[model samples]
Target: MDPSIVREIHQIVPENRVFLDLQERYSYSYDASFGEYLPDIVIQPQSALEISKLVKLANQHRIPVYPRGSATSLSGGSLPVHGGMVLDMSQLKQKCIIDRENLLAIVSPGVTTAEIHRKAEEAGLFYPPDPSSSHISTIGGNLLENSSGPKGLKYGTTKEYVIGLEVVTPTGEIVRTGGKTVKNVTGYDLTRLIVGSEGTLAIVTEAILRLIPKPPARKTMYATFAEFVTSGVAITNILSQGILPAAMEMLDQQCIRAVENFKPIGLPTDAEAMVIIEVDGHPLAVDEEIERCAQVCKEAGATSVHIARDEQERDKIWQARKNVSPALAQVGPTKISEDATVPRNQIPAMMNRLREIREKYQLNLFVFGHAGDGNLHPTIITDKQNKEEMKRVEDAVSEIFEAAISLGGTLSGEHGIGIMKSPYMEMELGEEGLRLMKLIKDAWDPNHILNPGKIFPQPGQTKVVLTDE
Candidate 1:
């Protein structure tokens, strides 16, 4: 970057906030996802006005501005692929006001989702978009990715709760979309458009999130199935019985063994699969729903059904589920996590496809996710340094996406199409559909200076490339 540009940026933000050192820029280079592209500079703007001015400067210089939060994206959403200015939005942590009267949370981009969850619960309310990485991931990133965890099966995703936003557009205009009221049906739903735009459409400085009354009581149960497909059958059975669990998470034998090996929780390693179900509401309703779920699991061929005796046991059960990602991370040097969602009934077939892909590529593949919502994360654990194995991993990932699309599924569920899944966007949305999306992107960011090299695939790019070679 030119010294003049740095001076201009420094004028907009504090000199201390401007990070030009390679050490600081390197920290912002890569996210949780694969690949790394160091940005030319990293700017921590604390206010919307500062960000607006910085964005204007970036647009004037044709520099790509990548707005990043806690960098917990699994799809490389925050990676500075274009190597320009990286806006560290985590510094914008001023506001996190709980509007109890309106059942809303007015928060800045830097606020962690866990903080919101904590405050909401304290206020006798609930904010249900609980991503696995909520403890660290910022609300800005969650809204951009529209992340949803197990509770999404019943409560819905981050976008559903985001009723309003204070955004800095790509053109450097600070604007407000929607409002505190949830019933607003204004002309264009720019809030929804920017919510899942992955920071391409605009940068969110603040947000108004809707909240619901906290459930009075909750019940949890875990069922182990002798056969993997039977576990999927049990899920279908539970849902068919009209029991809408707050969360329905499933783990394959690989994930089961991984969890036990990582930390012994007395989970049956020999079981082909395990399903954890959770329900909340009145105490009587919770008990009845859990019992019906247990009976359904037993009828669906569950080898064992263990209902949590109390809160401690319930947390222990949920802890086992939460340990999945870390446990799988220990399996190999690099973990290629992909959320290829399918229809609820097609889960068994999708699992079969993942198994075949794993065997065919000879890779360490494991499966787990919010099964109630049909979002299954088929992850491949491999060493990226191994060129030969990475080749196979690439092929396997492509096949996984193909399998999902074939089953009337999508390329992603919670994880957005940042760069890893960009090549397959057309495969799922078709050429015309993808073109319309591109039109929207072009209209929003004419200069393409905001979060470039993301979501949209480049010409001649047919598949994801993991290695520089």
Candidate 2:
């Protein structure tokens, strides 16, 4: 970058806030994705006005700006492949309640998801979206990508929880959409449009999210299955029996072992698969639901089941589930998590194909996710240095995606199709859909200044812009 631009940014913001050193820039280069590429500059803005000035400056210089939250992303969504400025938003972390009686919390984009949940808890309210990365991921990025979690089974995804948005347009124009009211049938629904734009449309500055009353009491259970298919079947049976557990997660043999190895949480290592189910409601209602769920699991071929005798046992049951990603990371440095979701009843078929893919690729795999929602994160751990082995893993990923599409599923359940899945996007959405996406991208960013080289591909391109230009 020219020294003039750096000087201008310093004039607009501050020297200490704008990071240009190679070492600091290197740290900001990558997210949770396997790929890494440093940005030309990383600027931390403390206010929307600071960001407004920075965005306009970057646009005037024809610099691609990558707006990042907590950088806990898996799809390289936060990677600045264009070598332009990365507008780090973690500094814009201020949060305050706009109106509590109206159940609205006004928060800056950089606030962690976990903080929002804790705030809601204090107010006798609840925020349904709880991504596993809630402790690290920001509310801004969650709204940007429309992230989901186990709560999605009952409360829907982030987009559903978002009622309004405050966005900084590519040209530095600030705008607001939706409002405090629930049934605002307002114009355009841009709030919904930008909810999952993945930082390509605009940078979210603040959000007005909806909150529900937290459940009274919760009970968690562990259902052990001799067969993976049986666990999937048990999930289907429980949902069909009208026993809506607070959360229903399934872990295959590989996931269980990986978690146990990482954190010895006293789980049955011999079980082929384990299903962690939870119910939260009135004491009497929960007891009845638990009994029904247990019966359904038994009928669906569970080898054994354990209902928590107390809250202590309950925490132990969930500890294994919580340790999944870190545990899988212990196996290899590069952990690629795929979010392919099929229909509720097709989970058995999906799990079966997953095992087949793991065997065919001959790689370390961990499969676990919200079984109630049919969203499974089949993680593949590998050493990227081995080109030939990675080729096999790529083939296996392609096969798994094909199976998902064949079974009426999309490529991503929560994680957006950033650069990671851009190559095979046409296989799923085809030429016409790709053109429509391009048209939308062009409408939003006529100059292609917004986060470019994502979602869609230009023909004959080697990659989805893997390096800083």
Candidate 3:
């Protein structure tokens, strides 16, 4: 960066908030995903005006601006792949107000999702998008990725809750999109557009999120299947019977054994697969629905079904599901997590294909995700340093995407298509569809000054390059 540009940036943000040291720049290089690209500078601007001014400067110089939250993005959404300016949005975390009357929560981008959950619940309300990394992930990242966790089976993704946004455009103008009202049909839905845009179009400074009354009562149960594919059968049967669970999570044999090994939670290691289901509503309705769900699982060939006797037992059941990632992490040094979704009916086929892929690649692969919505997370654990193995891992990932598209599914369910999944966008959307998306990106950021080298693949880049030879 030129000294003149550095001086201009310093003028926008105080010297203390501007970090130019190599150590500070290195800290912002990598995210939770693969690859690392150090940014030229990191700036923690306090206000939207400051960000607007900085973005304008970036556009004038054609410098890439990467807006980052807690860097918990699993898809490399926050990685500064172009090595320009890194905007640490975590510093703008002062505002969080719950508007109970309107059922809305006005919040700053830096606030963690878990804080919103705690505040909403305290106000006798609920904000439902609960990603696994909610405790650490900021609201900005969740909004950008439209991340939703296990509960996404019943509730929708982060895009559904976001009603409005205070955004700094790519070329540097502060603008407001949508409003506090849910039924806003005034113009284009820019709020929805920005929610999952992955920060290419604009930078979100604040957001207005919709909330609902918290569920009063809930029931939890887990069903084990002798065959892994039988778990999918149980899921389809439960949903077909009109029993909508708050969350329907599934884990394969590998995930089961891994969790049991990591923590002796007494999980049924002998079972080939397990499905955890939870339903919430009226007390009587909850009881009836839970029993019905168990019966459906049994009819679908579930080896055993157990309903939690109390909340403690319920948490224990969920703990087994929550322990999956860490448990699998113990299997290898590198973990590649992919969320490929299929239609509910195609889940069995998808699971079969995943099984075949796992065997073909001869890698440590474990599967789990929100079963009700057909969003399956097939994670591969391997040593990236093993060049030969990484080549196989790359091939396996490509096959996973192809299988999903063939089954009328998508390359990503909740995780955004950051650079990690950019190459496959054309495979899923076709040439024209991808071009139309690029048109939107180009129109929004003509200078390409915001979050460059993301979502769109470079020329001749057909597949992810995970290994360097």
Model 2, span 26-53: residue lDDT tens: 9998888877878999999988788888
Best by lDDT: 1
The pairs that clash in candidate 3 are none
Better of 1 and 3 by lDDT: 1
What TM value does model 2 have? 0.96
What lDDT would candidate 1 get against the real structure? 0.93
TM-score of each: 0.99, 0.96, 0.99
Per-residue lDDT of model 3, residues 301-320, tens digit only: 99889999999999999999
Ranked candidates, highest lDDT first? 1, 3, 2
Superposed by TM-score, candidate 2 places the C-alpha of residue 441 at a distance from the truth, in angstroms, of 1.4
CA lDDT of every candidate: 0.93, 0.85, 0.93
Off by over 4 Å in 1: none
